[model samples]
Target chain A: MNILMAVLLLGGLALAAGIVLAVASRVFHVEGDPMMERIDAVLPQTQCGQCGYPGCKPYATAVASGEADVNKCVPGGERAMLAIADLMGVPPKEVEEEAAPPMLAYIREDECIGCTLCIKACPVDAIIGAPKQYHTVVESHCTGCTLCVEPCPVDCIDMLSKPEVLEEWTWSAPGKASLVKLEGDSDARVA
Target chain B: MPGLLERLGGLFGGGVDLRSLISPGGFPGGVHPAQMKITAASPIVQSPLPPQLILPLKQHIGQICIPIVEVGDHVLRGQKVARSQGYVSAPVHAPTSGTVLAIEEHAVPHPSGMGRQCMIIEPDGLDEADQSMPSLCDYLDEDPAIIRERIRLSGIVGLGGAVFPTFIKMLRDQRHPIETVILNGVECEPFLTCDHRVMLEHGDSVVRGLNVIMHAVAAKGGIIAIEDNKPDAVDAMREAIARAGFEANIEVRVLPTRYPQGGEKQLIQAVTGRQVPAGKLPLHIGVICQNVGTAKAIHDAVCMGKPLTERVVTISGDAVPHPANICARIGTPMPFLLAQCGLRDLSGVRLIHGGPMMGERLPRMNVPMVKSTNGILAMRAESLYSENAQEEPCIRCGHCVEVCPVGLVPNELAWHCRNDQFDRGQEYDLFDCIECGCCSYVCPSHIPLVHYFRYAKGQVAHIEKERAFAELSKARSEARDNRLAREQAERAARRSKVRKSGAAEAAADASDDTEAGTSGAESGEKAS
Candidate 1:
């Protein structure tokens, strides 16, 4: 009779604990596409479709849904991949190849075949031209997506690397000046 | 005035015993370094003009100033040489009467090491002040807006190394009225005594400037904060407060000599006992903090109608033969000022702008001094900036945690930074760190904790910039897609209308043919 009473009491306690846990979860629960938003924010958002997805948002969705690999965003290089991996709570994997420096699409103006195919393909609306006139790209707005380069019928469009300029120069990370090192070196301690 | 009554309440004249309320209160971890104020004995001496002045257009912290004077144009002393671009910027004035020789890129005294637009002027040495300057008005009797305008026109900025335009700060929100104004006199940095000297010599001007600031903000009261270490500074300031008869409007608060006690947020907390929320200004807490030098500049601007051409700068170090405080002109080259102090050998000397603690090491000595320069120190190789600062692994001493004024886990932030986990560092409120170098000073491991924090901050800023660019691109892409869809829809609608009109015309032609056949048949029957 004592054993029966103890079992009943333990069952009641478990049920109460379960109800409390369920209520706590409901009270503390978050709403909205927080995971997708987080993943998308980490993306470079070039909308280049180089990752085999349509754009950065679509790829972010794919990564959140576990449909695409995190290492696929080549334009973002190692930085974006690491950031996404961090958000996903997964160990980062090495990419086979790092993305090269960003390149802007340059159209050879004299080629004379402005079929406007490149304009339609440009996701950023950086290209401006009539159906038959010469086309030009707004350099600032161009994402170096290469979408315009592929659709050019006359093969006149080419991607060029950005030129180095002083205005765009930024301060090197402060770590570059510090004595901190990943490897242990002699003469390291100074107090 | 209520401002006077409040000041009286803060003093012992009222019921509140302010001595009990006065304590060294601030944020989290911090370190108390040696005051090293040996140069406090030197009185303010006017620094002689240099042969050529290199005035960088980007003086105050904002958009670059637009050069109004062309090459070969003669500029008088205190004449506006450059126009301020926007409300956030301050106009740059000619330090002395000179001819604009060239406006080219010259090495500015910035840590970035990149040269910006600098106006090279050859001084004629007449030191001719502008004769047609604006008329001075009693700042107290004038409208607050007029006072702010006069302050802005004088090109006065926070001389506490922040270089933020003073006028912009004075324009507080009406919803949150400024209740208190604190002039930061706590020169907490080691090897810097310019502020201490400024108070001792120009106490009346500093108090009047505080009054003008209070008038501009319509604040109830003001406090001139000084370090307890500098007893002379406190006595001089108190005397000045009494002389100005502003004993009721302003009070003297002596803070314990601690590193970063002069920090805006730290000083605010020390004086008001209120913590300014992260990412919010002191104005949010009904407070406005100005530098002691800035207060003096405001008094000069409003009373004499003079522009901010010169300021009291502390020139001292072991490498210097004669270390003294000198009233130096803006845009004066570092070499000239260093020579006045009888600078020693330059080869092993590490020249730093501002105090030795937070001062930036000069890439080269020729960089021109701007409005925010408080002190210049030339340290011997083995002295202030120790070359043998051997960075060792963190021993997890919690010394940084104890000394941090912002109450941050600096070692953990440094760890995140070391491993390139800036996101995690940000989660720990990395930006909240003021980079006061206190953690590194107290660290037993000599880990250069501030360096890692700075690196982490820079990385976070770079990532944020990239993210902002990406957001802009995405918005553009979405807008472009919407435009294309709208245009496509319009074209489809137009095409359907054209098709419908053609169908109607064909149906009419068919009816006409049937009518013609019936008419022909009827005519044929009648003929028969």
Candidate 2:
């Protein structure tokens, strides 16, 4: 009789917990969009498939499905990658490289007949000025696609490397591996 | 007393002995060095302003502010000289009424000895003041967000050496419930007593500022954690807390005098006995920690309607004629400051920022003191060690291990870093290192472990960035390939569809012709 009572008590407690869990699940359930459009919105609309998919949208779909890695986008770099990775429930991978030297488009302001071909070729509209006017590359907006450079009749546009600022400067990591001597060697080699 | 029962009672009832208070703060690690507080306490003296102020555009940790005033523009003391770019940054005000000399890159207070965009202000010596201020009473009825904005506009930052913009830190998300606010009065570095004097002299304001922070975070209580070495500071704070009627909510916790106890994680552990996990902030553990100096700055900005323009700097070293804590205006040159302290010839002197243990060694004394400069240390040539000290191999003395506050095996990390085995160093949790210099300080071999770690972290960051770029390029290539394949497939399908329709049309025409031929044959038969 005692054993039966103990079993019945355990069973009843389990049944009560199960019911409570069911109720809680129904009450607190959140409806999430299957598309995860918000996560895709933060991505650089550059359609320059840096994220291992055919386009930004396909990569977004893959990310939402947990099939692709978030750190695949280089144009977005660390900051963008972090936001996407956080949304996708993944730890941010180490930034693949210190942001590649910021690439800027330099227009030889003097070099030419102001043909607006480069301006028309720019996808992001980084190039400014109307036809027959001096076209300049808004350094901030120029993605350095070289599409504009090729279109320039006078070859005025050049992809210039960003000037090294103090903030942008990082310490060179000590090359310790190179200091080690070859196996069965006598002296340490500084390569 | 009954023996066995009494012992058991003592074990249970004697709720955690007073000695448990000596147990260190929450985090795994910290560093300790020789305390050099005596340099300043000898006497409190004033330092005169420099002839020229080279204020860097990017003094704090965030975006550099654009110079609102151009060259030759006349500016007054406390004038709004530069405007902040974003919420994470702070505005820079004119240190003293001066003429803008140049807005160009100049040598900044950094280890790399690199140049940064600096605003050179030639002080006219008029000391003209800007008396413009918002109504003080308005703050009493102002929104918390408005108060925060005022603090940011004031250019206040963590004067505890981190120089993080205080306003940004104060803006906490309400979603994360803050349980406790830890006020860091630990002033744990050796020879740095600026915070100590601030607490002793301005205890009321500090407490008021802490109250404001508590209100901002809606924290249940606040703790003022100070090392027991500063009993006078503790007493002063205690009196102020009682006077403010915050005795119930705010308590003064006297921590054991240990090096680096002023560190955020260590102090958190020593006070709360709750370890902030690796790679997490104290806020994550339901606590928000602010330096005593930062809290005082907040009070000044919110209550006094003042921007962070001046700070108390401890000028002390063996070589100085007189060492004292002086209220220095930001952008004061080190040479001029030293001269004010009666140091004439600096030909063979070594100047360091902050305390000698963790402070960076200045390449030259010409660098101006920015918001983060807490202490200026000058030592005679004989007393200073060469930058490149002869490094000896590790003798396995375990001194570095003993002094490490984070409980990391520094020797292992250093070994991996030295061997260029970054992966191995990472495996030993190299990122967890705070680079506090305790291991380097205790090392008999003078291995410069902190430098090795910095180098390794930089390398890792670079490699990681390169890998990301490569991955991006690969992804782009793959995407192009996929698009081409899809387009080709679509073109093939369209071509096949067109061919099928053309065959059907051809079959219909042939059937019509056959029908016509049959009709013609029938007509001919009738004629015959």
Candidate 3:
């Protein structure tokens, strides 16, 4: 009889604790936003549609809604893709092979004819010049969209590859065979 | 006192501070090296200006300042000679009154030995200071935001090696609460003692600067971390803190003398016992670290309304006749500095900037002293230019692992870096390696582990850039394909519509002809 009473009391206390926990959870639970602003913030503000979406915000929204993969943004590359993947609780996918060589806008100054057509075509306003004057490219602001190239009548605009500098150079990773060689050598008999 | 409770308490405490043992302050790891700070005992001396100053526009780590004065334009000391191009960049002021000789590209002090855009100033030796002075005291009563803007307008940056803009760091979000402001006084680099002398001479200003920084960030408290090796500096800072009546909020912490202990992450760890996570900043861990020299600069900018025109630099190493710290004006050439110290025989002397460890070897002495240059070292050729033997394979003795302050696997990272396998290196947390040279210092094989890591990081970044371009092209091609398919479908639909209209016209004509035929037959029947 005593054992039965003790078991009943313990069970009642457990149920009470659970009910309290549930009520506390309801009171202190976080309200998640339907839109993912954090993912959007991680994206480069280029809005170039290189991510298979019309704009960066749309791609961010798609990722948040699980309608699009996180690795679709090629301009943002692996870092952005990984960050988005981590935020959305998904594994980072291998970047596509075609997404190589970040392009830069180059102006053929001779053929420009001082016309500001490319300036209006640029979405980021990377091209700078007054009307009927030679225009220049602000390399930092240029998103390499190639939109400006299409509008130039003289075909003066071209996409150039960014030059590699010592500052930007990184070392390649050592091969797996080297590690195996190290392991094998260590296991070999000493002379 | 001899009760059971007392005995139990005694057993637990043992009259010792438990905090001192077992990962005290949670500092990850560090290295020990020769301190070589005996050259700073003498007072600071000034060096005569070079005949010509090659002042690079891109000295700091941001947009290059554009030169406002052209060739033949006369300038005075402390004058706004060059303007800041963007918000993230700092302005270049006239180090001394001089005539603008030229604005062209020249050889810059860099590891790559490349040229940068620079302004060549020819000093007239008139030593006339800029006459304009704006009252800074009036802004003391004004809004703090306005004061910060004033500081930014003055073009002040961190005088430390990392020349980050000071105002950007001060403008913090109130949501991310800052708990402690750490003033780094531990100049851990060997053969450099400029910061140590600054602290000894200007301890009051350093403390006041700490107060200003704390006020800017709304931090609860501040701590000045000095190495125990510099007892005199520590004592001076402690006295200054006491005199300011901030002994409680502002405390002095004496850290173990270690190489790269002055690094932002390592210093934060030593003071607060907090470990900044991999790929995160000290701000993320509720801490902000600034150099001692930067603190003094901040104090000057706030009180005197002066921009960063001059800084203290250490001129030392074995080759110099007189090794001393000099308060050098910006754009002062290294040759002039070496001449002041009486340059030793070049037959066996090798000159370097900063320190032997982590400092770049100078290609020529013509490179001007920039904001990041802390020391100008001239060592014996035998010591500085010793031929290193070929690197042998790692013995797996774990010396590099043991010395790594960030707890990263350097051996594995270096292996991956050497073989061009960047993905594997990233998996081993290659980004976390601070390039402190601890791994190389402790390695028995004398492998350049830091070099390997730097190379790996560059490769990974390049690959990332390439990948971004590929993705962009793929999207463009896909869009083009979609557009072409839609256009083809529309053209086929238009052809079908035209054919249907033509057929309907023909049928209508045939119906009219049939009506005519019926009229003709009726007329014929009437005639019969």
Highest lDDT model number: 1
List residue ranges in candidate 1 displaced over 4 A: A1-41, A52-68, A83-91, A102-121, A128-139, A146-191, B1-29, B172-174, B384-387, B482-528
The stretch of ten residues in a row with the least summed lDDT in candidate 2 chain B is B16-25
Worst 10 residues of 1 chain B by lDDT: B16-25
**TM per model?**
0.79, 0.69, 0.68
**Candidate 3 segments exceeding 4 Å error:** A1-191, B1-22, B85-87, B131-142, B242-245, B344-349, B385-387, B476-528
The local lDDT score (0 to 100) that residue B399 gets in candidate 2 is: 67
lDDT of 1 by residue, B1-528 (tens): 455646866774576432322334554445778777888898889988888888988778788899999999999998999989877999989989989999999877765556789999999989889966665556777888888888888899999999999999897578889999999999898878888888988888889889988988999899989889999989999999889888887999988777898999998988888999999999989999999999989988888778899998888878888888889889888778888887734656766788877886665556788888898887775775445677778888777876788878989998998888887998988999898888888888788777777777777777777788899898987798789789777666755654565466557675545544554465445333
- Model 3 agreement with the true structure over A1-191: per-residue lDDT tens digits: 99999999999999999999999989988676445778876776455777778767678888899999888887677777888888988788976734557678999887788778888667566788887788988886677767788888889898999764434533333222211111111222111
lDDT of 3 by residue, B406-476 (tens): 87878888888888677899899988887888887788877778878877887778767755744554454
Alpha-carbon deviation at B270 in model 1, angstroms: 2.6
Which scores better on TM-score, 1 or 3?
1
Clashes of each: 12, 27, 21
Q: Docking quality tier of candidate 3?
A: incorrect
Instruction: State the lDDT of candidate 2 residue by residue for B105-204, as single tens digits.
Output: 8877776667788899988988887778563434446676787777788888888898878877666576667889999999888778888988888899
Q: How close is candidate 2 to the true structure, as a TM-score?
A: 0.69
DockQ of 1: 0.20
Looking at candidate 2, what TM-score does chain B attain?
0.83
Q: Write the per-residue lDDT of candidate 1 for residues A23-127, one digit (tens) a residue.
A: 998998888567888998878878999898998888988999888888999889998888899898888988667787878998888994878889889888889
